[model samples]
Target: MNRWLVPALALALIAASAASLLAGTVWLRPQDVLAAIAHPSDDLPGLIVLQIRLPRVLLAMMIGGILGLSGAVLQGLLRNPLAEPGLLGVSAGASLGAVIAIYYGFSASFSLASPLFGLAGGFVTASVAFLLARGGGTLALILAGSAVTAIAAAGTEVALNLAPNPYAAYEIMNWLMGSLADRGWDHVRLAAPFIVAGGALLLATGPALDVLALGETQAESLGVAVGRMRLIALIGTALGVGAATAVAGAIGFVGLVAPHVVRPLVHHQPGRLLLPSALTGALIVVLADTATRVMRLGGPPINLGVLISLVGAPFFLWLVLHVRTRTA
Candidate 1:
């Protein structure tokens, strides 16, 4: 796709997001949303639209884009379309740290500390998986990822179960389910730098990813430093997925599905796919989040992660089928 198209699509998505943000639990027209943006605080609706919904939507988009790009990079590196931070235990690791911090009451002491710890946990798990897979092939990577993920997920469940405070369990449950209902600029401020930096790193690795698409020996013959590229890409994935999950919890399927949805827009060129994947991911998350806020079953809202899983599970099955056919 042309460079202009990405920006154009982003703009359109932003506009749609803005409209959806305005039409939240209480419906508001597009003109009302525009008026609110123009003169925020002039009315209750304006304030809610500009101060509350808008920020959350923007943050969701940024986080989703980061996850999408990170997924694309990981899939390219592993030569597996099913590879994602969530599958590789990166999200589980981050969730473990964040939940631990929250359960231990550290989050109450310092707001930034939760994410810092979460980042550490994410890196640790990713490192373990990488080491376990380093000398082996795709099978090793998958096995390592599954093992680490299982362990970390069990640890998270244990922590939640052992928490003294009842609220802690609920909090962990909420985080696990994922939601953008009450997020604000502070969440955005906390996550944006890491996401942007990680995104830059991912974008920088695109050329190396393109070479890796040609198979390992061919890529090495073409002068691509395979090991170095993998290291950088791993670090980038940790940064992007860690920071996003730290803020939003494990918002699943964006990374796995975004690239697949937008790959055709880029004509199946791995390098060109990144931007479109990011855009599509951003659009998906923001729209899905908006749907969560708007759609209710009598009282409580639906889980964001559940919504994504509903969509992602079938997509995953289809991907497996396609991959099997291709290999066969």
Candidate 2:
């Protein structure tokens, strides 16, 4: 890894965060932003910067960082270049949970209902996957996760189908599309602890991940508890990605794309890839959210998750072609 790579990523994240604060429906100059931040007044600029954009930026950083870190860890753990947090069904479960909250009118009466349900759904589905895959290896875990994801997705679709009104269905679909728009400090408070804890857990597995790259038998021979490590990774991913989906709807692709973007910079070392991937993920999501604010497509800004998918789907195709060419 280059000595400067981490620092460079950090600098980029800082710049992205700044851009997130400044870019919105009503753009504010740097001077205005600084003034708002420093004074914390009741003025429109202050309210916009302090109350609206700041929390959204913070949530973007946390969610993106956790997704990236977890993606790197999952890739390393499974020895699969394409592995990501959602492979474990956490995101789907969370989405299902939130959808249920909305479908049942719980979210209408309680502001925290959706997120809380999302967290529970994520945890339960992840636990089911883990248990079903126990005593089996990586392949089993992947299969179990896929099954769970399918089930949860089906449940979500059923909720939509059974919705009493078109308005309810539209609301569910819009939430599923995902966005950081209108997010506030409450969301930050809700997701921050889980993201932080999950990130720490993922980061702690770095050395083990590097060892596991040599193969599971060799990793075990080196005194790495492969099963325990797998458990930790799964739990970390569920906590972080679950909370993110809970609050932000079903944002995707950050986990899938971040690690791949940073892998080369880190010389393809799993251990070193973690932090840089996290920073890059934060930068990507923050920039994407900022773009969502600025790029009004006639009627309204694009959903954050939708924009990421639009970019990521093409990148994913390119990756497939590149990999095929290399292996051919």
Candidate 3:
């Protein structure tokens, strides 16, 4: 692994985070941001920097870090370069839960109803997938996840189609687009614990993933508990990704892209790839969120998820072509 890779990613993430704090409707100078952080005041700049941007930046980091970490673990566990956290249906299930909350006006009654429902949905779907894939190998797990994802996606679509009012539909659509805008410390508080715990669980599996890359049979013969590792990966991914989706809505592609971007730098060692992938993911999200604030795309700014998808769609195409070329 390149010695400088992790440090480089860490430095980049720091820079992006700074940019996120600085770039907004009313841009703050470096000095202003520092002042706000050092001694928060009731002034507009202080409020903007401390209350608004700080929470958003922190949430972005947590979400991105978890997504990236989970992606690396999932890819390693499944032994598939194309694998990502969403392949297990957590994001879809979370979305369905949030949509259900919005559709039923549960969000109107309780601010956290959507996120809470989203968490429950993610856990349930992941549990179902695991149960279906029990005693089976990676292929069965993948198939089970695909099935759950389809079901959750269908539920989300049904809710959207049957929305009682256009306003509710608009709210649902907006949330699905995903954004860090208007997010306060409450969201950070809601998601922090889950993301942290989930991140720890995923990171712990790095060594096992490295061995499992050789083949499940070989890994078991080498005294690695493959089933236990799979369970850990699943639970970790579900918790982290689910909480992230619950708060931020259906942000995508970070998990899929972050691991691939850092794999070469880590010499393709799954264990070494985890931390750098997480740093890269945080950098990507911070940069993307910053871009959303500065860009003048007419009336309102671009949605965070939409902007990411725009970039990720092209990257996905390139990845497919690259994979085909290698195989060919």
Worst 10 residues of 1 by lDDT: 261-270
Sequence-dependent TM-score of model 3:
0.96
List the lowest-lDDT window of 10 residues for candidate 2: 318-327
Clashing pairs in 3: none
TM-score of each: 0.88, 0.97, 0.96
lDDT to native, each model: 0.81, 0.91, 0.90
Error of 1 at 155 (Å): 1.2
Candidate 2 similarity to native, TM-score: 0.97
Residue-level lDDT tens digits of model 2 in 1-328? 3899889989989988998888877989999999998889999999999999999999999988998998999999999988988999999999999999999999989888888999999999999999999999988999999999999999999999999899989989989999888778988999999999989999999999989989999999999999999999999999999999899988888888889887877878898889998998888888888999999899767899999999988997887787578669
Error of 1 at 315 (Å): 4.2
The better candidate by lDDT, 1 or 3, is: 3
Deviation in Å, model 3, residue 61 alpha carbon: 0.7
- RMSD (Cα, Å) of candidate 3? 1.5
Model 3, C-alpha of 79: deviation from truth (Å) = 0.9
